[model samples]
Target: MAKIVLITGGSSGIGKAIGEYLQTRGYKVYGTSRNPKNYKSSFALLPLDVTSSESIQNCVTQLLDIEKTIDVLINNAGVGITGPIEETPISEIKNAFSTNLYGPIEMTNAVLPAMRKQGYGHIINVTSIAGYMGLPYRGVYSATKAALEITTEAYRMELKQFNVKMTNVAPGDFATNIAAGRYHAPIAQDSPYKEAYGNTLKTMDAHVDAGKDPTKMAEVIFKILQNPNPKVRYKVGAFIQKFSIVLKAILPSKMYEAMLMKHYEL
Candidate 1:
């Protein structure tokens, strides 16, 4: 029997690449996006909006009603909110958390019972290197990914007995519209962080424009799904990301902060 795999935010970038790649490998792939009509792929398209509980519920319910079982679930729907901490409005911050953190949580909850009954399943959450290390102007986005990373850890432990594996894939920097589509909250002229926000946005745009191919990260994820025992976390993208992870572990707190400030031109 063909395995059924569902991916969220699969209309573009990494998610789309992964869905297409997996479809070629013979998995029965179902991908969700807010605007499914915008993309063409071999996988089936389902309408989904991670920020809305009703949308998430409707997607999952439709899948369960028709498919009966899901062999794998990929929680890849997320948004990037960029701006200095003080300049970012509370509403944008809330929206970021809604899509990045709570969205995955709700989706996982909806699928857990079915997976548990089926006796086998895999859950992959696409986090980011930002989750591992905080970057300038991306505080809220990073916080949301960090929350997902931590939650994945607990989920791995708890779901072990049920034979349901949970994995978190953290890619360094991939060619995606995330940076370009980043939401910038209103900042008052008197805000002290306005200059910092300008510098951070410039840096973000520069780095993202020169990011690695999204297919590279998608390939890593596909390989992980094929593994007999995938690790709790997998890092993809450039070697620099690995080096940064090491540096984060060995360097002093002040040194790490300095490196981030210098590299990001903040």
Candidate 2:
């Protein structure tokens, strides 16, 4: 029997690509979004607002009713909120955390019972390269991914006894539709950070525009699912970006900090 796979934020971007790739590979795939009807794809589409516990419960319930078990759960729903912290509104930060961090936590909790009963399951959390180090105007987004990384690390250890597996996928800039949904905090006319923020953002977008195709990440994820023993964390992107983690670890704090600031033109 084909394994049952569930993915959040599946309507588009890396999520959609993953769903489609898995579907072609014979996994019974289900993808979720608050408005799933917006996009058409080969994989199953379900309505899910990861930020809402009730919605997650309902969606998982519906999936369980039909499939009875979810062999893999991919927490892929996330948003990018970019702005100078000093100028960004509190509400924006709240919204980012609610969706990026809390949503995954709720979804993971919702599926644990079923996974535990089944005695074998795998979870893939789609984090990002930015999660490693704080970005200039994207600290809030960084914080959310960083938090998710920590959560996944802990869950990996906690779930070992249950035979459940958890993996954190830290991806670099991928050519996906993520930018379309990104929330750019409103900049005040009088805000001193506005000019620098504006200049740095263009540099950021340019790099993203040149990012690898969405299919590259989908392929990496596909291989991960097939592995009998997968690594706790997998990063998909350029060598320099993937090695950033090591660079930060070994380099002197001030030196590495300067490199990041130079990269972002901060």
Task: Give each prediction's root-mean-square deviation over alpha carbons.
Answer: 1.4, 1.0
lDDT (Cα atoms) of all candidates against the true structure: 0.88, 0.91
Candidate 1: residue 204 lDDT (0-100): 76
TM-scores of the candidates in the order shown = 0.95, 0.97
Give one clash count per candidate, in the order shown: 0, 0
> For residue 212, what is the lDDT in candidate 2?
89
Expressed as tens digits, the lDDT of each residue in 1-266 for candidate 1 is: 88999999988888888988888888889999888898897789999998888998899889989899999999998898887787678999999999999999999988999999999999999998889888787888899999999999999999999999999999877788887677986565887877777777777777788889888877888899999899999888778877898899999989999999988776
| Model 2 lDDT tens row, 1-266 | 99999999998889989988888898999999888778787887999998888999999999999999999999999989999898788998998999999999999999999999999999999999989998889899999999999999999999999999999999999887677679987777888887888877887788788888888888999999999889988899988899998999999999999998888777
Error in Å for residue 169 of model 2: 0.4
Overall local distance difference test of candidate 2: 0.91
